[model samples]
Target: MAKISLDEMNPAMKSKQEQLLGKFEKESKTRQFDHYLLAQGLYWISIIVALYHFGTSFIGYPATHLHRSLHVAMILFMTFFLYPANKKASRKSIPWYDIVLAIASLAVAAYVWIEYINFINRMGSPNTMDVVMGTILILVVLEASRRISGWPLVILSLIFLLYGLFGRNLPGIFMHRGYDWKALVNHIFINTEGIYGTSVDVAASYIFLFIMFGTVMNKCGMGRFFNDLALAFAGSSKGGPAKVAVIASGFLGSINGSAVANVVTTGAFTIPLMKKTGYSNEFSGAVESSASVGGQLLPPIMGAAAFIMAEMLGVKYSSIVVSAAIPALLYYLGILVQVQLRASKLNLEGLPKDQLPKLKDVMRERGHLLIPIAFLLYMLLFSGATVIFSAFWAIVATIAVSMARKTTRMSIRQILDAFSEGTRAVVSVAVACAVVGIIIGVVSLTGFGLNMANAIIQLGQSNLMLTLFLTMITCMILGMGLPSIPAYLITATMAAPALVKLGIPPLAAHMFVFYFAMFANITPPVALASFAAAGLSGGDPMKTGIQSVKLSLAGFIVPYMFIYNSALLLIDVTPLVALRVAITAILGVLLIGMATEGYLFKDMVWPVRIAAFLGALLLISANVVQDIIGFSLAVLVVLFQFYWKHKKQIA
Candidate 1:
């Protein structure tokens, strides 16, 4: 036996390493061509930048003077260095053009830095050449962002820019005198908004360190440990492996905070086991896609966007994590139930004991690895450190602990690899943040965020659900071609205020927007995670996407549930209320899984399934009248299933 690695058994996963790795081997040979080494250097460089920037700017307390130079540096690095590095070249090497581009980028930055001095000397006014160079730099940023995050954001930004330019010609409710290019550019560039505001601020600070923490953890066996942990916990029951995928992704999601990373990592293993156990290829892929795509909703860290959310709402990072506790649970509960029901439909059995890792043993060996994550939470809540400071210490703790055990210790080579990968991971986020900063800049300059919020509110006529639906639709459409962080940034900046107008709290509204941005990753037409799963499963990508949407039904509903019932979010929670919300949500998730998989105790009729869905919805909604209706209908469906089972057994 060649021993089944995560991907070899998965025809669907066979091409993934190639997709991710590109031409590293050949490129690794040369100094400039060495993508990995370059990545390594950049990672440590970022660490230094993070440390120096955070220390100098806000050691005693978080200062609001968000570093303009450092922030812009990260964006430019991602655009000209990291994003193009692997996709176009190598981790172990750099190409001549990369070096050329690098110098050019540096030159442009130098021009800005030097011009900044002269501008200060001349009473804050810059010259034409300075302005031209700045424009060129900003455009370079947008181009870089386009390469990494795709066109939805770029397109959205253009629309906003056009809105500002041609506001006077717009129809009723959308009319305003449009500004010229200079205003647009200045808003996005010269000010702390377009390339500099809260979006870029959070990115420069918290998001980067956490990303680095994930990188360190990755090399220290988080991937294998997470998989083994899921397998040990859930790999033995019917449909167990699929459930394992859900559980594993949900757990690892807290750290990686990236759906794409979660998908590629866990899908390589679990999707194959699903198919070998008789799960349909598309269904298997969908299961992985849905589960993995839940990363952005996972806590205590989510998509690195939660930190951003805290900054935007002006809340403590601890509060953001605490607020997220409930919704994240419901999200996973939904996936777990779906997996269990699917298992019932397929009649699959979990892996035999011989194949499973002993839970106690796995824990004994690697349990200390959990400390950094814990330390991170505690710091965010109590140490009074900024989120960036907390994440930096967490990264420090992760590296220090990895060395405690010989098995987990990073070799010199491994250390370099982790450093490299951490930098590599930030490329997309850094570029996206810069681009989104531009969007924010434009909105602020033109009052677009407020306008959009008011428009949505007026359109919904003060109806919360209608407003939510509209926001959801808009976010989904906007997120279709963007990364989760940037997608949420835009949503939080615009649509969230509309929810606030409708009496939703800022945290709840922003969290709601955050959830939808992630859902886009698995939504049809642009389900990036599902497409990855499809490649692994040898399944049709579109079918995989649609199935992913079906499997992840609870993801859509849970966000609505939380918005309605703050109790679910542990808002000023009591034990009784917590218990009630937990029970209702768990039951709701189970029913949802059953309805989608069309099985409970047995294959359900359309009527039974519909009843189950209704029951689940009612329970999830947490209203007394609806809960009663839902429970009664669910009982009726259960009785019907029992009756059919008894009849069949007797026959």
Candidate 2:
């Protein structure tokens, strides 16, 4: 076997990586200012925003509206300087108009607090100046979202705003009493229901701080530790590089919370390694993309959507994390099974042990990095700490823990850089949350959520299975081109309710939508994660996306399984039952992988493949009779495969 080097892939990988990120994730595409003044301004502004949020984690947030307002203001002020309005615009310096817009954004956000008493008193009826400021704030957010997230979010927000203003003229259930400009602006901007609603509230508090925690940890060499650790354990196994991608991407992507970023970060190394080890380009990219996308489904730092889910459900954030743990593990298991099976089928060997990091050595060298994560989990799950408190201390713990080794210790400059990066990392997400506030505001104001729910229920003819299917499609459509946080907020508002109306548990319904929303990153036509991976692996993007869907087939099914048996979610179940469900679910996912990959102990015939798939569905049914039937079918297939192999050998 040929030796594989990490640096052996495309020479222009970095440039391609940047191009792909810019293409699919506009939020990451920002100016690296050549002018020192503009650079310093962006840097300090980011630092101040990061520090403010960090401070609030201890000092406590201001009044809700004031806190969200300041968060949005800082976000907008930084966005104009960071993301240029046009590609042709200057990168070396800020344009004059953008500077004006920045100050105006700050002033508009400040107006709420300046007239705090009057703002509260005039909530029902804003004065002229209030309306003017509200209008400016709305426009400013729309423009900022445009620069950061591109036209999809901006256009969506505008449509919702228009619907709020003009839906009265429409016929049928969509119709509502339209609000004039003053009323609409007052409700959306002046109140906490629109731009300052729950979505922004989560972003302002939990999401931003968690993002900060991730960046700070990354600055302290956590990413390298995760990659090296995964390499140590998985890089000498069957389909080693692909398995490494799965493990490393899952670890990093969960905290980073951006599939595109995760793909570029881990895929740069893993994709090439997989290709060098004989995996097809499309399959390699698919593995990386699928794994990176699944990271958001993991915990304790699942996606930003998990934070929103906790807020909406009125559950402890730790509960959401706990419930997500099993299904997330099952998702990765399915991927790992298929990767191993593919390696077996192709007779591909693992990387030599000599070429891999020693697990013990890896643990000894940088094992301390895991301390902050353990501290976070303890605070969240056992200590019963507030999410903000846990996150703040986690950031502090990461810094303190980094001091154990000179190699990992963060200097003051590095710590400040982490703050700046953390704030910068959250820009697009924060903007998406703020804009989603418009959708939520419209849904609340116009009763569109209920109407949409009714429409989905009506379309499904009140059938639970059909309703789930419709909801899944609805989530995918709405999730396309949107960040996961906004996607979940929109889908949970519009689609999840339809499932709940059909008697699904509220958490189950929300999880259903959340699953599909995150999967949109690997769905074809607009699969940002897959496309990013393809760019790295030099594979066809659409093929990579299709492969990703196949590889993640179990993820699609897990939601439905949990919906059928809440025990899968660890809701209303005993420890024994949960364990039983988890074990069966693991078998079910592995069976599905075998069916998908068309291989098992030996090459699976078509009948064996079909039986494997049918058996998987049965095992996942979470019924005693069905599980028996599924297990029997699996055993029969195994025996039959052995018999066929013997007969062929005799021939």
Candidate 3:
């Protein structure tokens, strides 16, 4: 393949890049308040919100309704003031209607906070006023979701609402006994199982604090330090810039929950360097996007869904992290291997050593930035502290440790900005969680989740593999439109039960759904992360998304591997079995990557690629006989490729 220079690239690509970048920045960047008074007021509001949560984390939470209502109300208030209704809306001014909405946000939350005892006393028996308040809150949550997370989540929640209200009129498997408007509203509004459900509870308690931690860390220059550390480690290797992107984007994205946000943040630097280092624009974009998305699968601070997963499964947060460790490593390893193979096939060289930062210097300068993460891990994994408590202390640790290095210190203004930015960053996630709560509410009211799971089981004819495939497809389709947290929530509620019914453990089923849900960010058509990376890399969006799918083939496969051999997830497996599964899974991913890239010892013929693909499937199947046959096939293909390449060389 020929490499295209920047000047030689098509004009349309450049135009598309600029347009996408502008759109991404408009969508993902925090709003900049122009009025000093408004800015100061918003800053203080954010700080108060942060302090409220931070204090609650240690001092013990208030009543459930009081705490969650106040939490979400503040998020809604900030969201309305910060994010406009549309791109064309003014950034510098909050419209009068928005101000009213913001005030209404507080009023609604206040109503809940004030009437909590009444709500509990009159549970399942809401009055006209309760219904009215519930309706208003529902609408408010939907509108907030639309403003923040885009229309997909809001639309999905609406569909669920419609289904709940009018299910009697629906046909076939969708039919259910319908509830009246008041009944439905009460169930969703006054009930703890509705918008105040577990999803929002986790978001309010755990996710928000962690987002604040990330924001503070970023403000203190942790993001830059991670990038420099990655470059120092990988910038002189084969496909150095690409490898740097995988490492750096993964590190940053682990804390930054949104894949699109991650791409826009880290891809800005990594994508251009990759393009300069002779990777195709599409490949570079795909690499960063896929790697960034994979960070949601990483341990310690995975995506918001992980917190929800723990809550849903009634498992410890550290357990989720432990299970995710190997698969996340394999996902990145697959990406790194593919990039190296591509670089080797193209004879691409790394950046000059003199141009790269020295590892010792980079670490010496900002190494303290790592202390917060280490502290977080220790608190969560070893100290048995609650995730919320751990995150609260981690934020404090971040602020304290930043002062260790003059360059990384956060001043009072910067600390305030971090608070404001952190609150701003969580708006979409908080809204999405609230809206998804409505879906969960409806699912519980109508028994829709169990019905859907049964339908999938019947469709799969109780075949575990077929059921897994069907669930994966459902998750990907749902995820294409929804954000990761909502996607996982919906899938875990609906599709995971099908897997569990088929005799898969609950944890494995849920984890499988979570994996595919996150993968949707790189899936085609609505691949948000890929599109964001394309914006940064000046690549075609469709091409970059497709390349992302290819590059992340292991991610697409690992869920199934774990579902088959739970050893991959460290479930009831001995060390030897875990080691065997890990080895085979890694090798399978390597071969699959080679097949996808169409290069190994040499450019692969179609037959060799097919064989490699088949071999990978067999190897990842985790069957001993299949593994033996697959390993043999892989060896044979490698030898043939090597022989052919040597003969060609002689010629």
Best by TM-score: 2
lDDT of 3: 0.84
Candidate 2 lDDT, 262-373, residue by residue in tens? 9997788888889989999999999999999999999878866667788899998777887899999999999999999999999887789887777787787789999999
Task: For model 2, name the residue pairs that clash.
Answer: none
Q: Give residue 368's error in model 1 in angstroms.
A: 1.9
Question: What is the alpha-carbon lDDT of model 2 when measured against the actual structure?
Answer: 0.88
Between prediction 1 and prediction 3, which has the larger TM-score?
3
lDDT of candidate 3 over 196-244, digit per residue (tens)? 8887898888788888888999998888888888888988898899999
lDDT of candidates 1 onward, in order: 0.73, 0.88, 0.84
TM-score of each: 0.89, 0.97, 0.95
Cα deviation at 279, candidate 1, in Å, is 1.3
Error of 3 at 404 (Å): 0.9
Once fitted onto the true fold, the runs of candidate 1 whose alpha carbons sit more than 4 angstroms away are 1-15, 20-66, 82-101, 111-130, 620-622, 648-651
Candidates 2 and 3: which is better by lDDT? 2
- Candidate 1 lDDT: 0.73
The 10-residue segment of model 1 with minimum total lDDT is: 21-30
Q: What's the ranking of the predictions by lDDT, best on top?
A: 2, 3, 1
